[model samples]
Target chain A: MIDVFLDNGPAYLAGFRMTLALTAVAGVASLVFGTILAALRVAPLRPLRVLATGYVELLRNTPLTLVFFGMVLVAPQFGIIPPIGFWTAIICLTLYTSAFVCEALRSGINSVGVGQAEAARAIGLTFGQSLALVIFPQAVRTVIPPLINVIIALAKNTSVAAGFAVVELVATGRRLGQAIPGEAVTILGGIAILYLLFTIPAGLFATRIEQKVAFAR
Target chain B: MRTRMTRAAALGAVALLALGACASNGGGDGAADVDAGDFPEGSTMARLADAGSIKIGTKFDQPLFGLVGPNGVPEGFDVEIGKLVAGELGIDEGDIEWIETVSSVREDSIANGTVDIIVATYTINDTRKEKVSFAGPYYLAGQSLLTLKTNTDIQGVDDIGGMKICTASGSTPEQNLLENYPDAEVVPFGQYSDCLEPLRNNQVHAISTDNVILAGFAAEHDDLEVRGEQFTEEPYGIGLAKDDTDFRNFINDVLEKIFEDGRWVEAWEATAGTVLPTPEPPTIDRY
Candidate 1:
């Protein structure tokens, strides 16, 4: 088993690198777009809020695998051919995760009292200015934990791309585990540890931020 | 808080141990120690005879090769051969237990006594020979390609470079294609059946596996076809425990009879034979 790991470690690492790259790209894309959607939901315009709500509710209800399936089957019909497996998977991850991130941020926005939005408006600030300067700064600190959770979810969901032929961490582990008989238990254990190496840091970093911010009840 | 943590840890450990005690895991348990006196003298064949049934392992996914049918019974070329082996061993067909062993667990299933023999479309190779003994290279299957009916671009292996190809996960074809076509993208799926959709949708350029499996797909769908000559030689072998030399010999003898008496050709006409003609059965190598 050790020999298999030693011999195959580089391929596994290469696959892991692809997983991390996809997660990072998808994570940032989702955060930016999701934050925008969340802001739109809390905006003064009724139409913007309805659109944001619909986007989040529709995507969040669907399975991540089905979303990728649609990307392969439906996207091609639109003449939108994603160049490679990486982009296809990343695009799917971005769209699916943005919905959840939107909800998490919007929930944090709800927690901020309506009075805060009113106070900013009273100062003769536009709705956008009140959101960017007053409402968002406070809501972000509270939503950091949920944002981290979303990132963790994104990291794991990248494995679904393996079904569509993207060689990521879990897919690499699976190929190796299946090729090398009787060592599956050990190989899977190793793969699980590699996953922890990713997720544990996100968690620990969240704890540190929670401690540093120390928001009052 | 520290004392509470310690108590929870201790409680968790106890629960884990309790769960472990009840688990009959792979390569470790479930194979009972049969009384030596019950067997006919010293032969391993005695164990199968005394057990009243033999456990035969094969695949549960590959259509016409070794798939579980709509009625929940495993039907395929491998199944027919398994039945032939069971009948020759003085065991009734109903007494045979069919276990599904994927390529990964083919050797482990035999070593652990999960199966008396594996008739899965298992290829005979050097690396696997170290783990288990193979008898009667019953049939030879070659790696081939399955593509959309409209795919004129990828007629053979050479044209696959720079195109995405999907093979069954954990099988040899994935690595072989990757190594041969440095520019081609290879995807591994859990089952050969899973590769069909991606190929049909053009998410993948093609599906690659043993020709026998690809032929089944070609027969099922008018939209797919098995193209290109056999690119690689894959001799299908019957797997037996490493220690069971007598049992291995007995299987080879049965295989020879099947070939001589025309049952082998007859079995072929029924399953994978519907799509592919009967090729020469592989020579049984005692080694």
Candidate 2:
């Protein structure tokens, strides 16, 4: 059993690496895409806002695993994917996670005073400029904590990648534990440590940002 | 405020760097193989001779074939056969390395030398043989369609048309269901256990896999029954990498010895004597 770990340690490590990479990439992509979607939700055009609202509602109400499965199984018929499960997992995770992120950021945008955008407009700023200079900064300050929380959620959610056999952290730990029988505790402990390595700092960073933003106020 | 945000970002960078360092500096010597040749480096027999033990992989979830026992140890027919083979190679059962085998990953496990042999309830099929070698068609398995015992409309595999069936993702059964019942919606699960739970809940109309496995499930749950006779020939084999002819021949010889010495009968009694119908002993051949 110990020998199994000794032999397959690299595979476990590779799985961890893939998990971390996918999480980081998905998290950053969701933040950017979600912020834009949130901005659109509050834009002057009712039609655009309605479309953005519908997207958020549609995604947030659905399960992540189902999104992944649909993307993997159904996409090939439309030529969206030839037969790649890995890409399907990433795309689904980004889409699903971005919806939640959009809601969080949009709530932050709501918390920003309506007067700030009006004041910027009165000062001869265009709509984009008003949002970019006056409203967005305050919105970003309010949104940092929730955005960080979303990232952590995204990191943890990468475990679902294993459903498609895209080797990720949870699946790697399981495979390692199975390989080295009687070491399930150790293997899972290692996984926890790896996950904490990301989450702990992320939590700390979010709190730190929250403190700074609050201190400024 | 700007300085504080920069500090936080810097701290994040440091944390990421620490993670990167941990990854590069982990305890491994980093000399792992990416392919089957990594084992024995060149010779399978020599590698076993050097290690003084044989490593076998089997499932720890199926009841009669391989499953985790109440004692937290792996038990079942395939596991028993693995132990017998290990004993033949001059190693005690304790000396044998046991790894978890899932149907989705079993082939790669053998091909990559993650396991020397897979006694997982692996069905012998032509597609699998193209990837790895097999020692015995030791057990004959049959494909049976499983539906709720209360549901009488789906009488057999024939009734499965246009109904949703659950199968292990990427398995031959999934392909078989698609080829045979084109209109029946097939849902794939990561494991057989996943399919079975939903099957009992009626989330899926039928669960299709090997008949022996379905029989084992039926034996455990009185509410579940195997409806039709065996539909497919799913002979089971002990899997090894195709290049490991020496290991292959060794396992085959060990199997014959076990059959002759009545150890095979004992194994059947130990793992599935009660759940299965009766043991049909294979004709012995001296390899």
Candidate 3:
């Protein structure tokens, strides 16, 4: 096991790094985009709400692999070539993950009391102001755990990029496994451990944040 | 209860008859009349001959080499070669169990004894020889490029510098690009077919792999054409468990027999020869 790591340290590290980069970029982008979509779902404009709802329904219902296929294979026919490697994977993951994130945030937004929205409206606050200030603050606190879960899922979903040409952790493991068939078990176990290193820490951090924001209702 | 038992026995008999018919229909017309008694005692050939069955591994997706035919059995040059070897062991085509061994798992499959032999257009390299012994580079392929018909930019390997070349992951071509052509951007996919869409979409500049495999793809699609002469010599070999000299020699001998008897030419003409002219038979390295 140790020899496996020692021999293929650079490859394992490079793959781990790529996974981290993908997760980090996609995670942050989806959080931002999903929050906006969530806001749109709860907005006063009917068309915006319908559009956001349609996007979430369509994307979240579709398989991630199909989404990747569309982005890599289908999208290019229309001249929407997104540079094929890292960015393409980033776009696919974000598109797929943001929908789940949108639903999670929308649920959190709905969890906020109707009275709070009415109270903000009773004042001079507009829709955007109420969402950004009164509603979003509370919604974010409630949604952190679920939102982190989505991000964690996104991290694992980066494996799909392996098929499309991005040499992420799983692809790296596969390459290493092929190069040294004898050490496949050790290489795969090491990859699993590397994934945990990201996910477990993020889970614990979410827990810490959740406890920190645990206010008496 | 007696009537029901009689009905069940009749159904079982019908099923057995149907299976027998299917088996006879599916068996290819290449079973050799080798005497099992000719092999020395305790040898792999004698053991396999006694058992009257052999498990062969090959690629199911590679078109000219080992594509799965409409009858659900794989039919290609490699598969035909497999049948010839099995026939020498007194095993019929129906008794040869075909296992799909993709590029990456060929070594592992042989090492773990999941396959008696592999004829998956397997490229013989020193790295693989450490894990599994190889026999009869029965065919010699070379690393080449496949591009769109209209594309005039990449004519050969020299034009591939700084271009995106898609190839199967964990394959010799991928390694070749990574090692030899450092300037070329290597895009590795799970299978050669997986690269086709990307190549068609212009995401990859060209597809690079074995010339025969490229020819297989080109034969399937009108738009794609194989470009550039073969850059690297890829000796296609039969993979088996390492250090099994008896089995290796037996397979080599079978290959030599087929080469002389014109059975190899017939197999090639019926499969890969549709798209490629049959070349000189590669020398069997009896190492």
DockQ of each: 0.22, 0.04, 0.39
Minimum summed lDDT over a 10-residue window in model 1 chain B is located at B24-33
**Tens-digit lDDT string for candidate 1 (B1-287):** 99998988887688678546645352122233444464468687776776668899999987888898544668889988888887676665567898999988898999988988999998899988899999889988988888998999988887888888888656778767766777877877656787776677677898887788789889889999887877888888999888578888888998998899888898998988887767877788888
Candidate 3: residue pairs that collide: none
Docking quality tier of candidate 2?
incorrect
True contacts kept of 3: 0.40
Q: Per-residue lDDT tens digits of candidate 3, residues B160-254?
A: 99899998777767877887899999898778888998988788989998889888999899999988778989899999999989889989999
lDDT of 2 by residue, A32-137 (tens): 8887898899889999999999999999999888887666555544656522335656788899999989999888778877887778999999888888888888
**Best-first order by lDDT:** 3, 1, 2
lDDT tens digits, residue span B1-287, model 2: 99998988887688678657756665222221223433355566556645667788999987887888544678788898887766555455555788998989999998788998899888777778899888886777777787778988788887888787877654567667756778887766576656665565455788888876776777688888677766677677888888567777767877777777787888888677665554465542212
> Which residue ranges in model 3 land beyond 4 Å of their true spot?
A1-9, B1-61, B71-74, B79-135, B231-234, B237-254, B257-270
DockQ of the two-chain complex in candidate 1? 0.22
The root-mean-square deviation over C-alpha atoms between each candidate and the true structure, in angstroms, is 13.2, 19.9, 7.8
Interface root-mean-square deviation (Å) of every model? 2.9, 9.4, 1.7
Lowest summed lDDT window (length 10), candidate 1 chain A: A75-84
Candidate 1, position B71, lDDT: 44
